[model samples]
Target: MKTVAFYRIGMIICTSSILLLLISSLIYNLLPDNDIPQMLLLRDDNGRIIGDAPFAPSWQFPFGTDREGYDIGYKLLEGAVYTIGAAIIISLLSFIVAFGIGIIGGFSKFRVKSFAHKFFTSFYFIPQSIIAYNILYPVIWEPMEGFTTTLSERIVIEVLVLAIITVPTTAILISNETEQILGEEFITSATVLGGSPLFIFYKHVLPHLKMRLFIIYPKIVIQMLLIIAHLGFFTLYFGGTDVCYTPFCHPPKPFIQEWSGMMGTSYKELGLSWWIFMGPLLCFTVTTLLLNGIVKCIEGLIDHEPYKSKQTSRENETHSFESHSKQEKFLFIKN
Candidate 1:
């Protein structure tokens, strides 16, 4: 009961937060202009940049100003859209690839599964950050084409990178789960009854696999988000354009307004204003918590054994009652 209550609380919080984020993303994407908040613009005497420009946080500006005089709040909100969007794209792509490969490998003949396992083994040890960095090299060296592309292209890049990074681990995990299920008595009986391998695997095995995958989805999303955050901290993200003062871009610009990008830019300016760093840091922390909460919720949802057992017990009671009724009627008829 305690565990179930905890999960319920977590689910409510995570769902609310994610919904807020999605709404904010929709608003930001729809907005025509991406101007720095008026409060963050350079101020003239009397806290005005030229004549009427404002300075610092007030009702007009909630998060104050950055070193560049940009509204920290606006930027932070915009950043959330990119970070969340990227994470979603990556998570979905990774799941699709991992699910396909895992199912195939899990149900394959022994020889095929062995070869697939060996193929994935080499990638199992690669560090995610290193893999993300290596993947970024092409984007960095090529003409900056990612920025001019549509929103879908930007999402595609994130998804591809995340899928590549996450596939091996997810594949291994799902394959292991499937392998265990394949060893069950029902699976053996199905095989003995001349059930086709594919049909048995799909009809019998995948029902259980679906529940396991739901439980795993949140974990995979968290891992992919972490990887993207690390890459963003290094300024290797896509869709962001940085003004170049140097002949060549030194620290690569972030692709979009991202939590890591905000952190990358503002962590050093912590002395300027705690709000600058605190806002993004808080966001990152909360997002991590949200992901963990979501995982717990998913686990709770899939943990049907408790419910199933109760259901079975009820059915047994009903069956026993009916049996007793029939016996009483038989005795009455005999009398």
Candidate 2:
């Protein structure tokens, strides 16, 4: 009961927060001028300027302001859609690709399953983040002239790369799980009862896999978030990284204010204006924790031990009721 309560509470809070962030960001961007201040300065009672940009956390700006005077809190709110939404999309695409391949490989002959397992398992040796960075670097980084691809194109490329890189190990794991399910006694019984592979998978394996899939999805999202953060540290922002070679030009910046992009762009100011980077870092930390919490909730909710015990108790009760019915019928016959 406690676990179930936590699951409900955790889901509600997480879902509500994400919806709020996405909706607020949408409305904020939909304004005519899309007016969000680029700079802000603090003033005293007499209206004399007291402080410049990069203010500490205060009532006026809860998460404080960056060197450029943009509100860190508002930037986080606006970028929530990009960071969270993109991660969700990438994770979902990978899961879908993995699912199809795994289902096919799982239902195949032993040789096919073994080949898939051995082949795809090798992908685990590759460092996903490093490989992703190497592949995505050229296209996502602006050239001396300008970006060859548009922001949308770059984003799509990144998504494909990220999703494709993760499919190997995930598909292998899914295939293995499917094989295990296929080996179950019930699966054998179904097969003996003339159930086809397709029918058995749909009726038996799928129901069992559903809970695991739900649990795995959040884990994949967590991996994606970590990958995005790592890519940011590697100076590969989600959309594009603009490197300014001009002497007086500001440091390299991401095209968007996504959380990873924000972290990448602001890390240089860690010494003096730590808040600039820490603001986004804090948001990332919190979001990761929230996701982990959700994973835990799902884990607790899906624990088979308690459910199995309950199922056993119900079966026992049914047996006892049947025995009692037979005794009453015999007593009536003898009477």
User: Top lDDT: which candidate number?
Assistant: 2
| TM-scores for all predictions | 0.76, 0.86
Q: Which segments of candidate 2 are over 4 A away from where they belong? A: 110-112, 304-335
lDDT of 1 by residue, 1-335 (tens): 77777777778889789879868866986889866554334455786556222234557567766666677777778877777776777788888888888877777777767776877777767778788777765553234433455545655665676687888889888988988988887667566655677766655677667767877887887787777667766765555435355576555455567777777766666675677777778777888788887877868865623534334434543554565456653334554
Q: How accurate locally, in lDDT, is each candidate?
A: 0.70, 0.82
Candidate 2 residue lDDT tens string, 11-112: 778767766777887787677876556657778899999889988878878888888788888888878888988999999999999999888888888666
lDDT of 2 at 91: 98
Among the numbered candidates, top TM-score falls to 2
Candidate 1 wrongly placed segments (more than 4 Å):
1-6, 40-62, 122-124, 141-155, 240-252, 303-335
